[model samples]
Target: MTELSRRELVTFLASLGIALPLGRAAFAQGTGGGGDPAPGAVAADAAAGTLIRFKEPVPYSFERLVEETREAAAKPYDPVDVRFADTLERIDFDQHNRIKYRADETLDLNDGKAPIRFFYLGRYFKLPVGINVVDGDTSRQLIFDPKLFQIPADSPATELPDDIGFAGFRILEPNSERDWIAFLGAAYFRTSGELDQFGLSARALAIDVAMPTPEEFPRFTDFYVGPSAVGGRVKIACRMDSPRIAGVLEMDVKKDGPIVMEIRSRYFAREAIGRVGIAPLTSMFWYSETDRGRRVDWRPEVHDSDGLAVVTETGERLWRPLNNPANVMTSTFGTGSPRGFGLLQRDRNFSNYEDDGVFYEKRASVWIEPKGGWPKGSVQLVEIPTDDEIHDNIVCYFLSEKPVAKGDAIAYDYRLTWAKDQPDRGRVGEVVATRIGRGGIPGQPRPPGVVKFAVDFDGGMVASLPRDAEGVEAVASASRGELGKVDAYSVKVDTAWRVTFDLKATGPEPVELRLYLKRGDETLTETWSYQFLPLAQTG
Candidate 1:
């Protein structure tokens, strides 16, 4: 089998309505070109078999699943064998859409709070997953039934057998008109966020992503859904396997205002996996205001997430503005059991995006909160280049300090909140905006290769301070460049403070810049860090 790059996997998943999380540059090697199989007409298989049945109410528990997955990981990986995969692989987007799950067949789980609908096997989603329902202490596997799908007569999906199973499934809203959460395409899953628009995605695991070695994509082969003992909560269990690791995941999901999920993951490595990423988030940042000249898109801004926010263990908050760099870039922040981190869509106004169709402004911001004392690790942010919004170019996750050897076991407990904003500790001010332009005097022959940046900070104690407050200073530094013409002042509009500066390039490499507002001995805002790619975007 030819190893697939992360971009190729994303391209295939995006075709199936599951946008791949993360981005890649325009000039960089991409897998989004043509040659995907076209949609074909219905070709029913005469030898279709009946749906397979497992004993109902079989004894089951979260612990049992973890144990079983551990034993499975000790053995060699076994890839799925899809029957009539060639025909299924031809189910294009339109054809896949036509093969919808009938409303009458929606599973009535959890006292009918949300109906469960199965996704059909298609070209991009060829792996069939086993699904089950749990009641009390027992669980029963759900059999695949072609009759559950209303396939168009012209679609080739009818050719698949009744026992071919499902690609993944979704949880329909109370009205049954739309789905709020979906798990499809490998280990990828996402919620509609607090705004009910699906933009980015969160994965179960990430292995060696953007590394020299080809990335490993683990898949959830089975799912068990049940009513949680906790009030108004649902329990979901997953059995995931891959060439590198086998694991079990359990989530106590609640459709609160923020769609909170308490996730517990157990992993047993099948091999000596390097660089395991936990609680991975994937998003897209095409051309925002900071790099307006990068793309010719009509929108003023285009991005699902604009920055990666982190709260260190010592109560210090840091904000790193995301970018669509010319080349792939990875930033790691070493921390000892950090409070939390997330990729956030802080700009909430529709005017910022001017995209009414997709409503990018309403995209949700996801945050991860560790349940206990997390081991020493680093919050890693990987930014890839992309010319279009269709490609997800930003990925943020936690990398463990310790390496995992073959047969080693790892466990994590965390909470995922899909909210409009991250939890505000109200410790200091926040960066509201970041803008860049040609660095030079207004009309004095725009200097070559100089970039100007303006960062806006608002809220917290600084906004409440009098405009004439003295001793307010902008402390800034660059890792590999010369900082010039630095100025900081309080802007009357919105009672925000703005810092303007010019960066004189010292080399061709990208520069890491950090700045924070302070008044005498007291810091007034969280550190604002940005990656300045001199050669990537220019006025």
Candidate 2:
């Protein structure tokens, strides 16, 4: 797909009206205590009209849902029957935003403590999904009615049928006006995170991303929402379906200080799959401090995440700074039952971003911790080139060692934490900044093919070292280049240690570089692994 089309698809899927800055009072009504009503009951607001209507209750459980999904996989994939494609398309962005969910119509869960709101199907979101409210062992599907929304008189949505299903839903924080988590378009979902600003997103699964063939986007066809066993948390169970796969996913989401979600997914493949990405994360990485030459906007930096941090099964820490390469790039790190991994926006300085509108500094970093023993696999990182921050060009996920075949049943369980920083903070120094420039002495002529790299390290042991500390050395290596002028020393301005090196590429191929710091026999910093594109030498 073209870059613009890809950006549109991902951007719209990640967020629509869910992240808009609407007033809290608009969604703060109907907060009184009330239990879930019986089947066929109508949640109505006398002044605002009917809010929600439910169909007959159905027997529901996680196990039964899994069995149902497996049976669906055995049959041919069934596509969603969009009710009014033409009319819905007329409800463009402006018109769609004008149609709002009335505040009094909010669906109350957990004894009216948790408020839920629904999104109306519009131009981009035509394929609708079933939404159900679960109470104890039974679930009642919400019947779609036009009365739930306040549609503009000129909007084309009024022409659509009343049975046109919902586009997605969002969960509002109790006693607050803000929404913490939202699921919309495809199987994509995201939370406001610890910063209360939506940034990166997580998907149910990713199939053959960055492969030669077109990527398959398995969408959530149904969502069952209920109260979690853990008080003050919400449990969401989703049924996902695609041409080649069908799966069931359950997430117990808690929004306290940070958003924590325990996710369990089970998949039954209908066809042989080349690549299956479990716990896939999607974020935008257009440009950062490492490659400032690619900046197109006035902002100092524009990206949701700046690097990929991995904790290998062997307890080694690796940090790979993100890049916006000239071409699509895939980097694979062999991780056998990894301890943890995440895409981090480590830079918290507001001055670094300068843009107060989006507050890039406040974007939350998501960390994934595997629950059970995951099979031997590799954490694959795919970086797609983009000129703007609209596209979500960075995707990373865990790829299984064993290929998936038809009728293969696979399962994965993990915990997702949307926090201010990564959860696993080791005693080793962490990479703080990465910069590249000309490779010669300041007063000397710059080399044509050589590039200079300056990486700063701080935290852990590096922060404790004295300025006059001795015996600390920089360890550097390249896969296909000559490394020289290596130097590591403490900077007078900050507690961080600075490491600089010159790398001369011997060929046109990209070079993989590894660097770290050590004192005597002790390793002092996490390994900084980088992929240097030959074209980036100009920067």
Candidate 3:
């Protein structure tokens, strides 16, 4: 998709109250089986192989898909056209929810080890993706069948043609109604995380996100789903294409408390990508305890994630608390072969949120770990302002230091872990919470041109330290500010150490603050980094 068209498409989807921005397509004419075939009957002509039919399964492999993507990228881009007739056009949220896929019609793989279901085409998701079932070295494309869905006879979706095709697909838990993994719009896919609730989404490829120009969204045109080499995991090969880029992604996904995806991807740039993001993650962060004054919600907190956690190449763990800034903010942490990074929902106390409907505490943290020789880059974070929780206002990804030129062959290997907490590689204390307020001593007028931060650190060695532990000290610094009243004290409530400090800003420019707890020069916690935008400047 071209940059302008992609922006328009995503804007349209957001108008309909979707979670993440994804491209959509206009209706186009296509041909498929006219009627619903028998349960195991072929639905396409055997002579034509652009699309597959049950008549015969053809040979397929990930390498073939990679070659196909490479060749496609070498040529000009072609966008798909999609259309939905009468009832389907009126498939609003309620009506769409009513049109459910039949469990019996699910595509089974490895003798029912994996059961896949299709999502019906709707107003928000108009593009159709090819879905194929792979077995051994061969694969068969599943034809669209109205009978696959159980739609209300009175629903407008019934007016759609027999070959309306599928919007996306999802993988269901064995013997359960809940789905653990799903691939929806564009190149977006997500799992139900460690807590069994959907939160953030991971994209196959990201081009020029948070740049001056509009972001390019690569769409997955086709997906080959089959059993994995290992038991209990499903393998999906995706063909991604866009105006600026084309790529192939092979993902082996499995759910065992924490949902894990072993992703192998290769891309060919049709044009020089200004800024490409690897293992890009999209999420929402409206407001939390750190900026409670800015929040106008009844709930105590509202967000899918609260901070961006990173383990740098030098073994330094940094936790940068996320913010819904007044304007777009992009922070880059340079590293070489970084260990991992993620958008984390660290505060898991239900009492802190009191959101029973959309259990924010149950949302999962998504961490990206590079598997092979990762190129040098910076873990970049983009925080966009949002008034409500529906919009995904936060994005994090690894950006290579060098730009991707046209015809460049790009490859990356990474594993995504969607869990409740990131692995404690440092085994040191970590930031549990961050709160900000006006700076001043109690019972006195709040000081001007200053901000107070109360950061709580818990877990690992810090939590084990006694209340009267000696040698423990708070270390704080700022890029462009004067630090004042910095001290670490034990809190009674959560067995965590609270570091209270005040920052006297030198100017209206944003201040980069860093702090941590230590005992006689021995580091005791992960570094806490934050960008403090002066109130006067933010307004």
Best by lDDT: 2
In candidate 1, what are the lDDT values of residues 14-88, reduced to their tens digit?
533465445332210111111222344233343554323455678899999999998898899888777787898
- The reply for model 1, stretches above 4 Å from the true place, is 1-55, 443-447
Question: By the TM-score metric, which is better: model 1 or model 3?
Answer: 1
Estimated TM-score for each candidate: 0.90, 0.92, 0.89
The local distance difference test score of each candidate is 0.80, 0.83, 0.78
Top-down lDDT ranking: 2, 1, 3
Per-candidate RMSD, Å: 6.3, 5.7, 6.7
Q: In candidate 2, how many Å is residue 341 off?
A: 1.1
Q: Which candidate is the best by TM-score?
A: 2
lDDT tens digits by residue: candidate 2, 1-539: 00112233345443332222222221211111123432333334577656578999999999999999999999988776777789987875555655666566788899766788888887767888899999889999999877677665666876887788888888777665567777778888888889887778898999999999979998998999999988978899999999999999999988888899999999999999999999999898888888877676888888889999999999999999999988899999998889889899999999999976667898889999999889999899999887676678899999989999999999999999999988897999999999998798999888888889999999999999998899999999999878999999988767999999999986667899999999999999999999998785554
C-alpha lDDT (0 to 100) for residue 6 of candidate 2: 27
Question: Where in model 2 is the C-alpha error above 4 Å?
Answer: 1-10, 13-50
By TM-score: ranked, best first: 2, 1, 3
State the lDDT of candidate 3 residue by residue for 409-497, as single tens digits: 99999889999999555679999989988788999988887788999999898879998898899989999878998888999776799
Q: Model 2: clashing residue pairs?
A: none
